[model samples]
Target: MRLQTAVLLALTLLVGAGVADRALAWPPDLMPADALPLKVALRAEAPAPKAKVSPVTGPAAACCAVLELRQYTLKPGQRDALIDLFDRYFRTGQEAAGLRVVGQFRDLDDPDRFVWLRGFPDMSARATGLAAFYGGPVWQAYREAANATMLDSDNVLLLRPAIAGSGFADVTPVPPPVMPSPAPLPPAPLPPGAPPAGHGMLVATLYYPFPAHDAAAAQDLADAFARDGAPVLVAAGGPVLAAFVTNPEPNNFPRLPVREGEAVFITFQAFADAAAYDRYRAHVGTPWWRGHVLKGAPEVRRLAPTSGSRWQGPF
Candidate 1:
């Protein structure tokens, strides 16, 4: 299908499923003197189209223009508070300023961890948008509330989509929060076809010990998984989202910490639940993984989205 048609279909599904509603702006009164103008900075392209077949079954394509895999280590018992603040105050100003708030979630393995994703049309846009959001009014009003919930906000990886049709489908903007609430509620369940919670999406990051400085070598690795390895996992009943390869460009902003050194590749997939994950695990021992996807023994981690996560639509 055409990219535009696919995106429209994705948006319709999200809205019908009630995932399109949520807060998107920060308080408007607090714009900073030097902040980049929100309107100019937010010139983003339409989200990339979803693939007709599994990305793993084809060649690697650039997913989103630029993707950031971010993880925040919050204070103990503060994950919910942090997510509440984010849901209420972060999305609006951030997206308005230029960033695409892809999704937010609680780390299933780490109670104090909050993980989320956002995208940009390119690196230059990322730098501009982040600057505006940090320097803008919404953050000014709620910075303290937001900061109080986190102990660390430095775990981040800059990536590009690894396969054809690997990026997220276009989504409707999240509605602005209607009013401040005494407590933030968990984000609604994902729409039909999304991986279920107990056995929901398994977002895995594969950290390779060697530098993937060679473009050909990197493509080879990513393609191996996309074209060969991904099909094996799907046959086992796991639905794959997109896989990504780290972008080697130096961090444009010296401020935020993204892991440097070592090559990394990430995969997003989902199963029915824990039992389903186990079933996939049983298949992992097969030759394909040992000889291809995991042949190098990359560091792999699996994560599930927390209750307050807001990812609605075509994955």
Candidate 2:
């Protein structure tokens, strides 16, 4: 089904918004002399009991699952073995199990880490399919063979589709848009005898549910970091890029919408490089994040760019 239709159905199934006078009002152009009499007659009619909708009772329209796999350092010439095994086993197994792989990326900084997303019909189907896939013979053999090359820590996230569309589809391949080579940025004067490190860039994004009451509080945290902490690093001759919060919108997976309990607010920050990102995280994000943002919010997810990844605009 199309995303808009699914959203409409989901909203109808859930608690509906109260009817307003504006909605009931006939358009001036469409109204006739008899409209006033009809309105009066409708007002005289008795009200009916509203249908009760249980908040937690209904099935989600769709679900998205993220699986993160970390591999151990490969032996000499074992890289090809691991790749071929993943191609021949994991990909085929997941397809057979009825889960659609949406996105896949290999970490540029850490070659061992692999991240992928999958979509399911709903929560129940996701749970059933995942259990059956893991328990099946194909999965067992694949796991046993890859055990030595796999990292101990793996992460999985089972998320309900917030709006009405499926997650990224594996079948319809999309190539990333090529970024133009950087135009020569204007040079800034540096302190005498300072050595130059090439320009680096980092981007961070934060998402929050809509109608957030604590937007001011979050903005304050961002302001403090930029004014107080960033200046110190910049004075030490570090290059800083722009930082700002983005407005929330529908997720890349059309099924997830702003109306759902998903994030309503989004904050994005861009820095020069990994060193700057690390410094900001340590000096700014870690200390302030927990008390100001994390504590105030229910959930947050973070990601970094790598090979085979696509940007899903803020949601």
Candidate 3:
């Protein structure tokens, strides 16, 4: 399929028909000003055109571009100010540059952090649009006004679509149907707060290096996470999430906008409910978590939102 056709199809499936055309402003009121900025671009080339696959299989070619910005810590009561800044600067700027503002989120567990994802057509357009916007008088004025309160610099990441049905389209191209699996009976509801069955949790430990860790140390950390059954998790906004770590790469997508020596680590886990999360937290205390995963790591941050909506980057 041609790139344009695939994009149209994916947009139809992801965003409702006509929704993408709707003129929406950047930085909806909910976002914060200090939010890091990400610039994502999708490849203009189409993946091999194949018969529509299962909805669960997701889209074939990448559809939207995603950019993310991160704010490490906010002032005592600057949430509203930050939100206003995001609206005035980042959101408005992106929209003016002709991009689609997809979603924005604040970490439920960490109010100090924020994330936003926006979409674009392709790489060349993205580059041209960004250069024009950043170099324009409007962005310059906004930048000056935003300078004083900016918590950290922004990081940009370019992304292509991964999962099927991940786009904002309405009429998705259905994939070839497969034999349905035998439906299994639902499990009995557990009493009050019992942990859900078959659910497991993996905590991501991000390592940011001060003076860039030696390749050996980096590999060791990666190997450790792999051995512990938690390989480095890569998601759309994976880079921003890694910002809480040390030694962030420029191209790391969805990363927080943090500086060196301010390195941080984020530990993540999955659980059925609060009880399960508590159990795991208790079982993995400072010593265990530190010694096992965070050994040699400087700063550590942990968050687990009850709902996926809380932390708005890549899943």
Candidate 4:
């Protein structure tokens, strides 16, 4: 669910604005919309991944039992302002409302795109939590200022860990009591050369399989990643921080709509730097799962976390 409401919910996205500016091998299509086997949201059928790892323990272990992967499209040059307001005012308030702040990020490839993750213990918690946050004082005070800086905020995905031990770790479920007074608007940018925000190296690889031919095919591919692909990912450079599959649950909060009918296997990884990420990219020239999946490669996002994000990487 969105941490804050957009002030301008009625505005439509400019075609030349974002989604299309990115190159291929990205989601929502860098190629023509019809090129990929996974079209718009459709029923995705896959079993729980069989491969198991130790469950990730943190303050919000159950908080991330279900998750929201939100990507926002901002007006020109408004990204940083939104980031400032978001980093300063969003997390703690949302968490206090019984939701969890997972991580917040800047889409390294898209200047106008803001990506983030938040979660709840389960579907019931999600409904109760979202009602509290959106209906609470913090959002009401800053909603307009926060909304003024946006063009869109509806690109969202509902997800859960693909297997045990594959959800984000170190998430804080709530913050100590504090007032909702927002800091002055248009907050300052980080000092030049201050230690970069959390290594600034998170990559999300999203897999969109062709509609499941067999009930087991999708799960088989996910299982293959655990058995065969994850090990190679760690050895080459980055470590797989978490892995997620589409949360098949019905949308509990109708206020924020997630991408529907879409089945995706998303993985989060951390690298030392772009050089480290590039090295792994080059190493995967012949992907570990190349001959395994019938569909082409998945889309990738090179994301840098905001200063306030707890997911500052190397996790």
Candidate 5:
């Protein structure tokens, strides 16, 4: 597990865009023509069935039981500028405001795009933390600068750990000045088109969508991934960091839009660079165990680091 959760929350600032651009389409190499159907309707039915909430309770798992997967499409060439501001100022202020800033990154395929994760102890904490940060002085001071770096900030997914032991590894905190300078991490000798692998670690986020109507199946699928699918991915080549199932908890703070009908199991894997990711892909689907465990192919999103990205700790 990695401790990228708390720093991301501060990066979500006050902004208004009529609409945000959707994530770049899944990569061609990853999305096969005969692959399992990838699209699901985004809206849940009215009078939506209540999503069950199961908050992880304990001292060790203090952050990120409930998380948000946030992606922002920045104005061309403005992604790094945002990351600089986030690392130097926003992350510290966000923590002070009581929000968890999970990990943040640059999208592998889209240079102008950024993605990050945020966590909450529970839904109520989410409301309070967000309210405190959004209404507090930190955001008010930097709102314009932060808003200017973006084109849209609306793409977000509310998620939870797929199973026990499914949160980020606790990385030691590196204060802004003491952290390493913004240089692309050395690339592992991976080939082109794998996840980006230059400055920092690359994370491959696999999204496995279940039938919108089958809530039980969604949990079952997540369970199966934890028991069977994860090992296969590791055996093939992925060094998995963590995996999570989408929480059914309705978004208490409706101010930020969430995907209503979608249900997915998400997995994270770290690679030295695109080449390492490609190596994992080479062995991923061909295994016999895959046919036994996976019911369908998943939608994949690979993220790499911007100059400002950081992943610390034992993980």
Candidate 6:
């Protein structure tokens, strides 16, 4: 997978592996009055001639160009209840309705937050699938239990892959092992053909209104990073797997909200372990662009994948 976005920050900000440097020039303020327009969304490519795969797998995932990056704020101590409800009951039912549960995770930085990704073939499928799943028997039956675990569920980002052929459509999903009942015991053994459950960490970085630069400057910066920054990240021991940008299209499914009117670019990376991630930080001395290029620092989340993910990148 290719993280097609966040080229600017990940590539530029190597200084200290995070945090802004407070001693640099603010370039955007010096620009001419007009803010040049930037092409925030990547162009969509034509599809291949293969037969459509229902419950799309790998190559068929291109069907789901539109994605939802949802982060929920849960009430303290309610995280386990929500995960149990989701792992056992929600995954299959949602898939059955034509949407894909791309992956789910526990935010290592914040124990009270749950993060998940949902995919749709397109905006139309998004509306259709969401309506069905939310109105279907499963959600109707368990909605109460699911809702009880959260204090807020509206922190969602509507996004799409940043480059051609770099979408989640390339991620092959495995059959999630669901519990027979909502019990606290460990999950049963994996059936044949499933990848062995493994351990690792995923880091997500967000570039939101990377303050100061005009649209044109931001786009130029992003392009530069895509070409030069990837190798730097790899050299630092973090393999960024996916890149995404905000979907400018209006929210067709108004019933479920998404973060609108905000400029966001994101990158997802995989690390072998916590220690490996630490080494990566030490390798990249401070990012030279931190204080000079972006006024506001991007948000980074170190994530732990949940077992119920239909797909969790190459990890």
Question: In terms of TM-score, how similar is model 5 to the real structure?
Answer: 0.66
Which 10-residue window of candidate 3 scores lowest in summed lDDT? 235-244
| Total clashing pairs in model 6 | 12
Measured by TM-score, how close is model 6 to the native structure? 0.70
The residue-by-residue lDDT of candidate 5 on 1-315, one tens digit each, is: 111121111111000000011112222223447765232212333232221111111112224678888888899977766776666556656666566676677777888888887777688988877776666666666677778989988877888866554555432232332222242232233233323223535464554544553546666665655555655665565655556677788988887787766776676666667787788788888542353334466656677654333342112
RMSD per candidate (Å) reads: 13.6, 19.0, 18.5, 14.9, 17.0, 11.9
Give stretches of model 3 more than 4 Å off: 1-69, 87-89, 95-130, 136-141, 151-205, 208-212, 231-315
How do the residues 266-299 of candidate 1 rate in per-residue lDDT, one tens digit apiece? 6666554557677877876563435443326665
**What would you estimate as the lDDT of candidate 5?**
0.55
Per-residue lDDT of candidate 6, residues 79-105 (tens digit) = 766776677768777776766787777
Which candidate leads the pack in TM-score? 4
User: Which wins on TM-score, candidate 5 or candidate 6?
Assistant: 6
Give the lDDT ranking, best first: 4, 6, 1, 5, 2, 3
State residue 308's C-alpha deviation in candidate 1, in Å: 4.9
Residue 289, candidate 3: alpha-carbon lDDT: 31
Per-residue lDDT for 41 in model 2?
Answer: 18
- Model 3 clash tally, residue pairs: 42
Runs with alpha carbons beyond 4 Å of true place in candidate 2? 1-81, 162-292, 295-315
| Winner by lDDT between candidate 3 and candidate 2 | 2
Which residue runs does candidate 5 get wrong by more than 4 Å? 1-62, 171-199, 287-297, 307-315
Backbone clashes under 3 angstroms, per model: 11, 15, 42, 6, 22, 12
TM-score of each: 0.66, 0.36, 0.39, 0.73, 0.66, 0.70
lDDT of 2 at 155: 40
Model 2 residue 157 CA deviation in Å: 2.3
